[model samples]
Target: MNVPVVTGETTEKHPLEDYLRFDRLPHIWCPGCGLGTVLGAFLRGLLQSGLTPDKVAVVSGIGCTGRSAGYIKLDSFHTTHGRAIAFATGLKLAKPELKVVVFSGDGDLAAIGGNHLIHAGRRNIDLTVLCVNNFNYGMTGGQFGPTTPVAARSTTSRTGNIENPFNMSALAAASGATYVARWTAAQVHQMERSITEALLKRGFSFVEVISPCPTYYGRMNRLPTGLDQMRYYRSNSVVRHGTNPNEVGVGVDGQIVTGKFIDIERPYLPSSGDGNNGG
Candidate 1:
């Protein structure tokens, strides 16, 4: 099925519509892609936070997940591969009033972009990151990504993957994110809550979304459809917070841990710096 793309301007009813470049829609993403659900949660979060599109800047890296910024009605910037966070940092520092968001795939964030991710978390910059962890490099074919499970099958790992995956939320929290949370695409309501809080947060905020890669990850794993892919999260997922990552594992079905694991106040970057300029 072809994805539908609607081009239009922002009206009084859907004011944010103007920020989007709808001509790029009917995105190359596969049908029933979890990215769409993540996008919906993002919009709902913005509405709940009362954020006007003009005041928000959505940045994305290369990958199927990066396509998220294009579908949204906002000041969206599709940046170079693995550089969404770095670009967003500059944008936020230049215009303190605007909310900067980084959207990237698991590989874009955890592997190729790992350095940027850690630095952004360390500085506690005011930016919200929505990482869609599909576990493999879906857009470039089902190749093994850093987030791919140890035993998951991929094009590169015809038998099984041996590399360990990163627990993004925990990594962000330890690195210094003021807000950290994890949720699955199926948990839309909770995901919205996480995004809303992240947007309103003062310091670096990280949200790890467990998105299902049906066409790539699912097919390689022998799942029938995207709906079957969801079963992996529903059955194996413990839905427990603060549990030992080692203790929680995806069984034959797979388990997705979801919840607002952490939140804290931190100094905003704008408030810092030498007082000689204007003050």
Candidate 2:
């Protein structure tokens, strides 16, 4: 189905519009939310990857990011909370020819779906996982989550969060993901490039995207606007490809190390005869 793209400057339909479900316009994201930016990058990445939209399956769990499934004009699945990876795994196994991608938030992917995330990497599943780390549960009234930076304030952590945040890229690399990368929502080009690279990879691939939840996480942490957070990323983020993922933990108002940290070839489950199958 062809849909016309309506930009302020032009009325011509955009190439990317062919990959979006236009009926879901006026997304549920907040005014300053970065999920929209990330979604744009994803769509552009999909277009650049040269993958057929009908052959791609997007799976999303319950969260702000999970809404991606509903918006993308692909074979998509909106799964239960923290189960997007599991559902994607099934989809991939059932139809090994399909390209399975899981798009969800840090809270859902790292907090509850963490086991599936790690196991997918460990098993060398053929999948691409995009985890948007907003530092808090933006959909659920801005609660602290597994990726919340230490000493960062959230609705639950009024004073500050005491728990250490997970270095998701590091975790993915350590779990045997063949491709691992990290980028901020502000770095649209780099994010899109990384996503394209991950999509082309054969084994388990993971990309951790640091985004802003201006309404909740940002408000609680003093970055009241998305532009403020983007400025922070511009100043604090350092691109160091091949840097040790373990040393890239984000802290409260600290430096954000971003880049393609790991890219290596690994055997998929079927090739290894482990009874697993991946493209």
TM-scores, all candidates, are: 0.87, 0.93
Return the TM-score for candidate 1, rounded to 2 decimals. 0.87
Measured by lDDT, the strongest candidate is 2
- The 0-to-1 C-alpha lDDT of every candidate, in the order given, reads 0.79, 0.89
Scored by Cα lDDT, where does model 2 land?
0.89
Model 2: colliding residue pairs: 5-13
The list of candidate 2 runs beyond 4 A from truth reads 1-11, 270-279
- The CA lDDT at 175 in model 1 is 81
Cα lDDT tens digits, model 2, 139-223, are 8899999999888999999999999888899989999999999999989999999999999888899999999899999989889
lDDT of 1 by residue, 153-243 (tens): 9999999888777777777887888888888778888889889888888888999888888888988887746787777666655566655
Candidate with best TM-score: 2
lDDT of 1 at 39: 82
